[model samples]
Target chain A: MKTCYINGTGCISTQNTFETDFLSEVTINNTENVIYANQPSYKEFIAPAASRRMAKGVKMGIAASSKALKDANLTMPEAIIIGTGMGCVEDSEKFLKSILDNKEEFLTPTSFIQSTHNTVGGQIALGLQCKGYNFTYVNGAVSFETALLDAKMQIENDEVESILVGGIDETGTYTLSLHKLINLVKSEEDKPYSVLNSNSKGIVHSEGAGFFVLENEKKESSYALVEAVSLQSSLETEEVSDFIANFLEANNLKISDIDAIVLGNNGDVEFDDYYDISNSLFKNTPQVYYKHLSGEYNTASAFGFWIAANIIKNQDIPEVVSMNALKKEAYSTILLYNQYRGKDHSLIVLKKC
Target chain B: MEALKQELKGKIIEVLNLEDIAVEEINDNDALFGDGLGLDSIDALELIVLLDKDYGIKLTDPKAGKTIFQSVETMATYITDNRTK
Candidate 1:
């Protein structure tokens, strides 16, 4: 199969990813249990009237995708693929609240129409006037990985040359409340939360949108070569080593071939072990973790992917993201592994273009 | 009748989330959609709910909204004739 090239990338996260230099000036925001995205000026990217109806997720996706296309110099792609855990959640809450508030009498359609999981994809297509194959995946943490795999497969098959793929999620008031009540979010008193060495029961929840433009051919701004991607719906924490070994072996690589390892460590005591147990297999390898900077969300791994690609493109891993003192002679190939709560584990390998 | 029209403008602005538009700017006979206020189908649905919720008027057919929601004058006239609460 031909290699899938990451021609462009854009990220809007809790750390001013949209307008900053790759964590150069990142200030950890542990003051809140739930962090909001560091937003760009939406008026520059969207019309005021159009933006008024958009939830943060949709707006972020639009801005990110637009920036990605401009960075890749692509006006329109052949396909648009999106992955999201909870889609248009603000609209979902609004629609549901109206249903209850009026006793099912006077519900409006604006929020209802925007609440669909595919709204981001559909709206992007509408904006671009690109009437091509579009899809949205919503399989929990693996949602973004699923879209990435599909885009990769399509590019490898030569069915499409260029594609827009993104993973986006937004916070909703009611949704956050539910997560807090269920202990899925870090406790209120857990502010100043440290993602690496925490005794917390849950992660600091946040929101973000990460988008990438993938093409069959590498461009001047191409970030990396997407060598391989793998997903496992369920895996015992003990089985992670063999799972990675098989993936690396299939790609004609080995554990030593990996330059850096990006692990999803969100400081949930129960699940940080998923990342910690892998430490033995990659003990000598330079390890990196980004949830500390990006915050823990379903598609936050997409931010990890952005970081990995940038690491390969620039050949320097920011000290802010390093999990340990280990270093490589030249940061060439990067392997990113992410999962949530012992499920939806995905492995993606990226090599310098 | 004039008071109802003025009240409808405020209600429309509040319900539809038209933050940029002021009540004084909307003429009683001006169109509520397309060329006038630039409202769309979605806003029409919101107004449908507003009519039902605030005036006890039920509109099951969406096409009926095209006539009743033509302007603040028409909406106020409809509410004065059919209001239940």
Candidate 2:
């Protein structure tokens, strides 16, 4: 199989991941029950005419993808694939609300037309005039992982030399309110929800977009090499360790071969133990986590992927992203593992190019 | 007629999110669809909603929208003659 190299990455999240160096400041734990992304200036990247009709989700996706393509010095990729859990959710909410409020009369088509899972990918393709392979994955937490896996396979099989892949989601007030009603969002009383240690039963839900360019050839600007990626639908808490062990064995690697382990601990007291399984297994390895900074969403793991890629390239873990006191002199190999409520388990390994 | 044109301009700027364009930039006879104001089919839909929601004017045929939404002056004239609210 051919190796896939990370050409570039652009992320817009609850933290300053856009144009900022790997986070250097201490992260402020948000106290709100439902958080929102720390958005960048869309006008800087998107033309006013093109942006007028776009929902927040599409704007974020376009901005992030543009940044990634520019960073890679790529004018256009051969394919564009995007992963979104609730695509153009704000538009969806607006269209649905309009239908109900207006009794389905005098309704406009702008929001309705943009409220699909593939809208992001379609918009990007339209912008670039790229007609190659285009697809969107919306498989819950594994949405981003599926996109990543697809890009990797296409590169391995020589179907495309370069591809732009992204995971995007935007939170709407109505949806967050519904999530709060079902206790899927952290309670308001849980002031300053901590991802590592919290008594909260739910997550401090937020939204973001993370985009990357993957290529078959490594360049001087390459961030890291994609070593391997594995995904599982569900896993018992007891099976977490063996699942990881088997993944490592399949790659002919041992537990100690990993330089650092990134865990997805989102402060959901009920399910945080899922990280404990991997944490204990790699007890001596440097531990890293970023959900405390990015917040929780279906595709939030993409932000974690950004953190891991940066770590391998920089050879220094941001002080704010550490889950354990352990430190590494040089991070050459990084492993990322994430799951949402014990489902959509994903493990990705990366090494410095 | 001028007042109605100004009101329509403000609504277009607000409804369509024309962040950079000011009210004065759009003239009364500036074509709203093509090269004059550079609006498109999506903006046409938004204008249709603006007509119904704000002026109580109902437009059913998408083709009829071409003449009614030709310019700010035309839209204002149609709204003045046809609005129910």
Candidate 3:
């Protein structure tokens, strides 16, 4: 079996991820319950004519994927896979609004055509003229992990030499309001929002896109090796410890073998207990968390994945994302755990190349 | 006729989302497809809907759009003759 290496990564998050170094300039925003992605100019990656009808999610995906491919020094990939939770939702809202306002008449085809969940994958393929096996996964919070697993399996089996995988989710006006009404978004009273040790019941909602290029061979640009990925639909708070143990065991690893652990603690008082269990289990390991920087989104785990990749590549972890005061002599093997509202649990292991 | 042509240019620009293209850049004789304004089949469908919604011109034959949408001059003429609203 061939090894799957993360050759390149591109991330667009609430922080200045796209244009800056690895978490060089970090801001902890607890004031607003909802945050927006720090958008980079798309003119460099997408043509104006082609981008006129694209939604924010689509533009971000294109830009991030372009950066990932360029960073990997590959112009084309044999496959393109995307994982998006909401998936071009702004266009979905626009199309729905036009239907309601115009009495289902005079509806333009642009918004309706761009509203599909596979729009990002299709658009990326179109831009690259890549007619390869393009797929999009929409399995809630595990969407990104699912896509990563698919690409990893294909590369391991020698099905493809290189693949582009990404996870994208964007905030829409109507959808954000609906989430707020349902109390999925943190209330104003929960100001000074912190992802760690927060008493809030809801999340600080945000949007972002992260893309990576995976190849079969390790190169100088390789960031890390994808060791394994595990997904579960649901897990109880008590079962969390055993879950990580069993996963590491399957990968011939133990808790002590992990150098650092990237946790998905989104500060939801009700569900963060899952991380608490792992926190105690890996108390001595270097701990890292990113939701406070990226906010809570379905594919926010992708941002966490990006952070882990950079940590392995740079051989140093940014202090801004450090959850504990612990330090590691070397980050050889790292584990990533993410869940949302106590469901769609995922565990991914990455290692230095 | 001049006012209608200018109106057609503006509407086409707005509806098609030609953000980089200005109204002054589009001449009445410029082709709306292929070599001229570079409009595609998708843009053609949008123009069809625009005609129906704004000018009350429902084109029964899709083949006629090839000629009717040749230029701003052609579209203005077609709307002037066929507009029911």
Candidate 4:
């Protein structure tokens, strides 16, 4: 298989991620258990008429894709692939509520139209006018990884030179309430949450959009080469360490070879132990966690990918994202691992040029 | 007639979520779509619901809105002429 490289990346997350630097201006979110993305000025990236009906996820995806294209210095991609676990939840909730509230009489089409899972990808293709191979994945937490694997496969097979890949999820009022009722969100009193050591029942739920431009050819703005990507639907918490080790070994790498490790620690009391196992295994190596800054959403691992790519390219790790005091020398071969509710575990290996 | 036009403008603004636009900015004779107030298809759907809910007018065919929703004047005339209530 041919090598695939990350040419450009963009993110809009709970923290100030749209900017160039990562983890610089982010505030340690203590209050407000439901974290919201520090939104980019949508008017700058989207025309008012097109944006009027878009849910938050669509806007974030489009804006992030636009930035990725601009940074990659490419106008059009051969394909656009998107992954969204809870696609357009706000629009879904709005339409459903209206249907139930008004007995389905005076409901409008805007919410219904935007409620589809592929709205973001469709709107992006509409904006770019590129009717290329478009696909959207919605397999719970593995949604983004599924998209990544597809993009990688396409690149290796010489199906397309460039592809726009991304993941996005927006907060929904009723949906959040339901998750809270199901104990999916941290309780109200667990306001100041910590990921490393937390006595909590749920994750600090948040929303974000992370997009990347992947190409077969390395360019000036290329961050790193995507060596490998693998996903497991279910793995015992005890077996996670060996699973990661085997994944790294398949890519011709050892645990010691990884310059840095980025873990998805979403502050979930029951499930965060997955990340904890990996952290304990890689204790001596430089470790980083981003769910605190990006908040914990289904596709938030896309933000971790963005962070790893940036770290590889810039060779700088902001203090805010550091899980420990350890610093690295000449960052290279960064590994990213993420999962949600102990499902959809994924491992990605990136190498600096 | 003046009261009806004012009410229509406010309803249009509220239904469409035209956040930055003001009610006074929409004139009774100015085009509601395209070049005048610059509304689109989605806004037209919202208007369809608005007509149904506010004035007891139901437009089963969306194509009818091209002329009915052309402007505040046009919408008011259609509502006054065809309102079920």
The RMSD of every model to the true structure, in order and in angstroms, is 1.7, 1.8, 1.5, 1.7
Q: For residues A1-353, could you state the per-residue lDDT of candidate 1 as single tens digits?
A: 66799999989998888887777679776778888898899888877777778888999999999999999999999999999999999999999998898898777888898999999999999999999999999989988999999999999999999999999999999999999899999887776688888888899899999999999998898999888999999888888888898999999998889899999999898888888644598999999999988888889989999999999988888899989899887888999999899999999999998
Question: Of the true interface contacts, what fraction does each candidate have?
Answer: 0.68, 0.79, 0.89, 0.74
* CAPRI docking class of candidate 2: medium
lDDT of model 3, residue A274: 92
> Over the stretch A16-118, how does candidate 2's per-residue lDDT look in tens digits?
7786877854356676766688888988877788888898889899999999998899998999988887778898898899999999886888888988889
User: Count of backbone clashes for each model?
Assistant: 0, 1, 1, 0
| True-vs-predicted CA distance for residue A308, candidate 3, Å | 0.3
lDDT per residue for candidate 2 within B32-54, as digits (tens), equals 87788899888888898999898
Model 4, A83-180: lDDT tens digits are 99999999999999999989978998888999999999999999999989999999888899899999999998899999999999999999999999
Per-residue lDDT for A159 in model 2?
90
Please write out the lDDT profile of model 3 over residues A115-180, one tens digit for every residue. 999999999999999989999999999999999999999999999999999999999999999999
Residue B48 Cα positional deviation in candidate 2, in Å, after optimal superposition: 2.9
Clashes in model 4: which pairs? none
Candidate 1, residue A107: lDDT: 72
Per-residue lDDT of candidate 3, residues B1-85 (tens digit): 9999988889998999898889899999999999998889999999999999999999999899999999999999999999999
| Shift in Å, residue A192, candidate 1 | 3.0
Scored against the true structure, residue A308 in model 3 reaches a CA lDDT of 97
- Which of 1 and 3 is the better model by TM-score? 3
